[model samples]
Target: MTVTDTEVSGRRYTVHNPATGAEIGTVPDCGPDDARAAVDAAAAALPGWAGRTAYERSAVLHRAHGLMLERAGDLARLMTIEQGKPLRAARNEVGYAADFLSWYAEEAKRVYGTLIPSPRSDQRLLALRQPVGVVAAITPWNYPISMITRKVAPAVAAGCTIVLKPAEQTPLCAIEVFRILHDAGLPAGVATLLTTSDPAPVGDVLLDDHRVRKLTFTGSTEIGRALAARAAATMKRVSLELGGHAPFVVFDDADPKHAAKGAALVKFLNAGQACICPNRIYVQRGILEPFLETLVARVAGMRVGDGLADGVAVGPLIDEAALAKMERQVADARAKGAEVLLGGARATGDDLAAGHFFQPTVLTGITRDMDIYHEETFGPIAPVIPFDTEAEVVELANDTRYGLASYVYTRDLDRAVRVAEQLQFGIVGVNDINPTAAAAPFGGVKDSGLGREGGPAGIEEYLDTKLVGISVAR
Candidate 1:
């Protein structure tokens, strides 16, 4: 939609449409000066924002949520055109994003502190959670709206100001979200967005700015590492939601059809670009063949086209680089003797071939040594491996450096609970494929990330604990 951010006055960067490789918008490639300005604005606004009562902040966010609901369709369409997710999935993301605003709005007023009695009868101690000052939220492009909402909701709820830098590819959604919140009575300078293509510069600016007391990021592990290192220098509070190679395990007691459906749903959602999407599948030998057959049939049935197209199950990858990466992974797996059970070819059609379209692919016979099995395949590709024993499968699933999310399907509740405990991921799903919810804590362990994103735990990321003591005299 040609969203240019000349309004902010900075370096220019183009946003391209993944489905067509066309420039949909141009935003300011904000530099250090712009970042400094944003930080100054946030700092200027913090005093008043922090002085407002929790109910006041909650009221503003609630109004923002109402605005989001009214414009949900428009935001979803923008996400589809800019982010290359199916229309239905884009709509779902908008709804999910709105839910974060609503959930955190109520959570804002519920920030609870506790009192502890001292051994001495005259002394009492109070523990309180306070806002962590200015927050620098760097979000990814996959779920632009939700990622921003996830970070901003908590920060705002905690009475903290924020300077957000959204991914260059999908900054429009976040910009629009900020605008909506601003319109919903968010005080000027309480929140600001800085768009920049160079992440290094942004990270440096955010790290160097003393006004920025915290940094929250969602992206690649390498970038997360760099940001963490930089933030550590400043001793800024950091919350990272990094890379993942989640395992989707199907036990012998699983329903083949159900497992196949779950695999298809999770693998193709957001073109499998989500950090927590199930990329690696470990199926028990008993139902391996039937599960593979069902998965192949379902993948073959998916309609690959533009995200804006009605009923399109699969959309283009974010860009040519992502498409090339997926192709290389598929080729490497095939070269190492992995069987192509379903679709494996790059898409070719009148308009589809010109874009970043790729068919939903399934690979079997993948071993532990292959890159596709161990690495994160952030595309619409699923690789299935057969395991003989529960212990062996659990070990294999935990072998990767990432421990973001894991899935298991079993009718036996005891076995499901045992396997769930054995898995080292932050979020585990037994029968349901959808593990992410507004009410549940979502994050990762190890290299996947540090800190949580959802539920009550999410609010803690934006808060700082302080203890106060009072003595009573007789």
Candidate 2:
């Protein structure tokens, strides 16, 4: 067994690429003890790492950002092989992840505290932000590199040492991140990567430990709820980026071709594994036919094959479970009388037969009673529904329990502002499919998860506030 193969209790889990079903590598099956050890290491490094001036920490992060850019190609290749996203998309993700590290590096020096005026003459009151100590950061497999960096960058920027628990399927990418930071002169134990197939032991140990002060997780809403409940006992500060049932609303004034193409691009990104991808679309009845035609044309143009292939656009789902789930949702929608406008089943080409490939599908005539209407179809399936009025569409959009992200396309300025304000989603895209950046806040409200990430709000999640007062009266 190689170093990558961490044998814990004589069990090793092998990771394979869903795009081609090829064995990528194996990692250590870490247990509770290993998890605890990672926390201890972080704790041991906390004081030294946190004691440094913000400038010093910023320097290290900047160096890491530089390293990330320099090695982006290798990193992107590794990510594509492990996560099964197209090579172009993987490259973009690597660059985006580097942006987070670079942005937070500068933001670290700007974690400003405020001073307050006291009612009395001789009293002075001030507020200061302090590091939250060791952090337990858990990231999911989809967009593995970006998710880990998004959490890790801010935590480190806030002067908090962290132990990253990356999803089992994408441990190598996480390990590569650590390697880059280590090369950038980040002290050992300041950042640790713990790879494990069984997360229960690690989660239990982290939640039980007082040394771990903050927990940030990116995953499904069900798991997010369980983690939040478990951490409630310890009262650890938590940030959860959970599930999203996003909606893309296109008005009659909008260009049907542009809107349709944008929808297809966003929906098919990462094979629609993104939490914020447009889950449901509400187009004005007048433009529905044109939108559907353009959307089908775009969907039909997408190439589903190995991620490494030059012209391939759509890659495989992460695993058999995801493939089965996509199948069920399609079948459920069909049973409820939804029309399959285009490809509705798995791709049958010889090139994609061994992989977990699903064809990009378009559906119409869907009703609220259908599973595709409410359930998160985290696959390459577009369910388009028609709406008559703005009020009716807004009502339909806000009906879901999730409020992560939403999109709107229209020429009316008043309507755009009105609808965007009325929507309950955390992030809104106006004539845009992508709403994410390092300088902007990312996260959602309601069941989509609590708190925020990115922008100034992100670093705040890793910090605690303290108020101090001084009075001198003789």
Candidate 3:
């Protein structure tokens, strides 16, 4: 009952560690009334928070940034327990989360307005940026802490009060973030945090209320679409960071070992639950053999176990559903003539028996018929599909409905620039595996989602432009 079931009469939902299948904590099952109250609190705090000088708000955010780094160790450990990423990776995520707060602190002061040239000497025209008011931010479970800061920091920096609902599986991480913000001198009611297993009631309140001026969400595309539709009812400003079927293209000129090394590093990150992790890796046919050899060797070296264990390169999948999805993808691939180049099944060991553990798998001979080729595999499975030419590869890569992220590795500058430009993805990495940063725009085009986060573009999402004209006294 503590971690398995959501009872009808129970007021709380328990959170369990996927690494060990043990109960970690419980959170209240918030409903419509709690959501309404949160909106009220945020609305009441808006004028005061928004009225503060950008310098004053920046000071608070700067303090929060410092606190995040000072308490990073505890935060990382807590993330490892709740989100199941390896300890080292969790530490990196905490640092990444802190950078957003730091970046937005500077941006708070940089929210500039412009004075337009007037047609008449006696008249003045001005363009100003104003806070959009209360925001509804919903975050997913993966990279729990980072997602919160990515959305919440920018909104608060723009002087918008927020009501955030963290994913049910990771409320404690959100609670910790609120604590840091409060300690950093953020006024009460400026940010309201809600925990809920039944999200429909809360979601309804957020989308239906005109008081919640904006809605920001990070999750799957299916749910993102639904939320966007709901937000349309009230014309709320919406930002959705949804699913990605990313492609990693490796040209023949690139070193096979280098490409494989980068592939292995990013593919198994958070056990590949990340949206931007490459779903399909396209290596030129001339160099496919060497790349496959190196990739298999590196993939075989990955150690899958509990996140707290030292030297564990890969951690457990979030739950049984994720583990089953991984198995089903592999099963579908094998049934349709895909070859398993490396670990293809669940990690079987006494230590991992209780948890949802999947071995890092590599599949070759991927065809259009295989489920892994057409579907988004948010798990530790790398499907390497060989292509003959740059043109063919680009076509294959861009065939999916998603256009969030893409990667290209090439020694030839011409090919790198050409392929990156023609790829049609929002974020493209040239000879790089990771393309995310606090001061860089991050989002997608097409069905991937709408709006951007991180960098200067992020804070803009929480602001509305106001135009003013005045006639001077004659």
Candidate 4:
């Protein structure tokens, strides 16, 4: 059964499994009217939701988290079917998503106000946080459940009502999430979900509507910029987690095999569909050859098939468009003289012919002229480039307009610290590939996107700070 009975806009659209081109289910092809309704619902519910105490807000989120854990197995299977990640990865995503809700549940009670000493003895000063009102959250297809939870959890925790628009490609997982929230006692209209194929019209309505006080998005940088421009007219607050061309660097002191292994594991996560996946690899010249060899070998051994199939480490790309993009990127690199040291093309046998499957690929002899050198390769291909020194690698890494996240593998404490500091990205991983945690802030600087998500700061994104001053003796 479908998760919702809400009025759908326009026609019904069928969602397909990228791995087998099989029809999974249909969702309402929502449009602007549906978007408006969701916004209206949130606006109507805002006062009551925002008026609730932090403890009350936290209690609902905690219930949702518990419900999520109780349904983890079902949600994970559904996620794997629609989103096309390995079943194990899907299970982990569900758990991580639940953690976000649970973490924000606790954080709600900790949104402390500040008191300040006044310059005048008889005056008083105070700073307090209040909900930013209605929030419009747009999430991507890559990490469906977590992206939604990451944005929704904090907004609700901050006493804000939300209207969520999940990517059309993966609405089932999101629908399930909202169902859990509803079951957890989230008041109707406090949280609403809209599944739509065309988001521009919907986004336009949300951005133009004065009722939406804040907007949070996880998608391409291009879309993020467009949304930001639209939000500008309304002067609404926005938090964007956009595209990333993350760098994975290995210094001479690091173990080439270990660095390569870590890099390989991270690059292949979600079939390299994640925004923070490493797009480029920079290895010190002294260890370049060994690193490349190990990376190629590691990638060579990974299994590529349906996400639900046993032992399948990599799954299909989201759709044919993604597969074509990967094809073009690899073709562009090959034409520019980058050697295809490992799997470099789409998988073909009867077992994989119907699927949007690309083999886990590794390319070396990369140069600045190659497209993969700068563009975000949202596929299972790792482009290995060599650097002569720390200064050169740092310069090369920071040259891109994106500053989302970067990784550095080095045992030298001073070098690691220096490089980490020098890197322009918002989050840096030293000797580790995964830098994310529920307690740490994530987001980027420069063109990668703006504002922050996760951590204590995440709640702030959904809140407005107000200062009060009183003349006690005037």
How far is each candidate from the true structure, as Cα RMSD in Å? 2.0, 1.9, 3.0, 1.6
Evaluated at residue 33, the lDDT of candidate 2 is 74
How many residue pairs clash per model? 1, 1, 0, 0
> Candidate 4 lDDT, tens digit per residue, 1-474?
111356556567889999998999998877887878888788888899888998998999999999999999999999999989999999999999999999999999999889999889998999988899999999999999999999999999999999888999999999999999989888888888888777788788899999899989999999999999999999999999999999999999999999999999999999999988999999999999888888888888899999999999999999999999899989999999988988889998897988899999998888898888889889999988888988999999998999998999999999989999999999999998888988889999998898999999889899889999988976
Which RMSD does model 1 reach against the true structure?
2.0
Q: How far does residue 158 in candidate 2 sit from its true spot (Å)?
A: 0.8
Per-residue lDDT tens digits for candidate 1, residues 105-162, read 9889889999987898988899998999999989999999999999899899989999
Between prediction 1 and prediction 4, the one with superior lDDT is 4
TM-score of 1: 0.97
Candidate 3 clash pair list: none
Q: 44-162 in candidate 3: lDDT tens per residue?
A: 89999999999999999999999999999999999999989999999999999999999999999999999999989999999999999999999999989999999989998999999
Model 2 regions more than 4 Å off: 1-11
User: Which residue pairs come into collision in candidate 2?
Assistant: 6-28
Superposed Cα RMSD, model 4: 1.6
Error of 2 at 38 (Å): 0.6
Error of 4 at 380 (Å): 0.7
- As for lDDT, the candidate ahead, 1 or 3, is 3
